[model samples]
Target: MFCDLIRGAAEVSICYEDATAIAFLDIQPVNPGHVLVVPREHYEVLQDIPKAVGAHLYQVATKLIPLVQTASNATDMNIVVNSGAAAGQNVMHYHIHLIPRKEGDGFDVPLPFPGSVMPNRQQLDAMAARIGSMLRDPLQNDGMKLG
Candidate 1:
């Protein structure tokens, strides 16, 4: 049953595999070199994923980050998951999204612009600076300083 599921995977350009987990390309990708990391055993979503399976899947996903960046020539990437129908999950199989991102991809996965209220250049720059500063020391003001 599990073998069949893995076999049915189409448009997969597998970069890594193991006894328990496998990482492959996403057929209907939002961007180039988008990949899916999945466990060999079938699971509907994050809540159903076994602890061992989840651990191995995450390990493989972490290891593939650098590879994805190098292969796709991207400066950054997004690791995402849509668990259910409400969350936009079309597939029953549990998987992780490894999307390689460039400067301008026309698809904003993190931020969305609803309506016509767009921020001016100054506002945008201020927002960017705030985010950058927070990112530099995320735990500082949050009372959880990093070492």
Candidate 2:
């Protein structure tokens, strides 16, 4: 569907659009101005998207923040992107959610790394080391590629 919206095959109330990306209202909006932005090209996983396009997504989201906030009278913003199924990415197509927020809205964005307990400093360092080793080429994460 996002591809359909971008292609004009599916009817969508697009709020913004350009050669590289597009923004539109979410059907199941967390708030009235909740919007979703997506790259013009279809990509399921973050690793598969080019850096330029990924950067463009953030640019578009940043650009939309104030506009959406003003429109919805939102006091805060929740910008989110879930990369994989384990990360809560329901839609395979890559996208970003721009949820408008207000005080006592009764919604809380889940922690990025939710778990039972916090890790100690030593454990944190080990975790960072494990991921830092893969920073050189995140797309090829030693058989951990999402796509």
Candidate 3:
């Protein structure tokens, strides 16, 4: 599917492209100027992508933000990625969504919870420490040289 897009055979409008990644206007957009940024190489999910490639995808996405905002005259934007099937990922390839937001755009953004819960300091600290301990050096594990 993506190979077709890259080759200009998919009939989708191309917005930006470089050697590492490509950004295109989403055919079914939430709002005008919505784009999807994808790496040139296949990566099924976030974890499957090399850290440097993933960073490049995001870097391209970030660079396009101002352009999308100006073109759409959007007040804000949402950078989204549905990583898995359960999380609404229909495309097998990894991509970052660039959804432009304007006032009364008719899209209701939902929160993870209806109300915020304040966790105790001890609980928060413990959770942070546990997560920090599990973070591996990508270079040591995968030999990824991220700039």
Candidate 4:
């Protein structure tokens, strides 16, 4: 279904396709020749994806990076993933962004804040330590095993 939507769209120029993945242009692109690399499976997010599928997706992306750069004539690019709704993921299917960037492209990624109050480094470290301890404790028994 997802592949159909991508392939059917007129705006997206397909750069590559394989059994496991497809690379196509982004309709609402951040830059010229912005591409979306998606797995053939319909997994919603990275955490839900099986390791083998995830590896395949990464391999596809790696293979297409140079092709996208050459085709778009871009010196550099940004690869991004928005895993959930809160993270600006409009689609439920898993996809990786490949945005071609050039000098003075008149694009600016929004930062969280302009020199806003930042979290204390020491406090963050302490919180991480506490979380690590809780995660290591067998009593918690959360289904997630961080081996």
User: Among these predicted structures, which one has the highest lDDT?
Assistant: 2
TM-score head-to-head 3 vs 4, winner: 3
- 85-120: candidate 1 lDDT, tens digit per residue: 888888877789999998888768556636558879
Which lDDT tens digits does candidate 2 get at residues 31-146? Answer: 89999999989999888888789999999999999999999999999998899999899989999999999999988976664765987999999999877778646574654544
Listed in order, each prediction's TM-score against the native is: 0.69, 0.86, 0.82, 0.79
State the lDDT at 98 in candidate 4: 89
Give candidate 4 misplaced runs (Cα > 4 Å): 1-3, 6-12, 110-116, 134-147
lDDT of each structure?
A: 0.81, 0.90, 0.87, 0.83
User: Sorted by TM-score, highest first, which candidate order results?
Assistant: 2, 3, 4, 1
Worst 10 residues of 1 by lDDT: 138-147
Q: Write the per-residue lDDT of candidate 4 for residues 103-137, one digit (tens) a residue.
A: 89987665786877788999899999999888888
* Ranked candidates, highest lDDT first: 2, 3, 4, 1
- Residue-pair clashes per candidate, as listed? 0, 0, 0, 0
Clashing pairs in 2: none
* lDDT of prediction 4: 0.83
Candidate 4: 10-residue stretch with minimal lDDT: 3-12
Error (Å) of candidate 1 at residue 101 is 0.3
Model 3 C-alpha lDDT per residue in residues 26-73, reported as the tens digit of each score = 988999999999988888889899878998898899899999999999
Off by over 4 Å in 2: 110-115, 136-147
Whole-model lDDT for model 3 versus the true structure?
0.87
Best by TM-score: 2
Candidate 4 residue pairs in clash (backbone atoms < 3 Å) = none
TM-score of predicted structure 1: 0.69
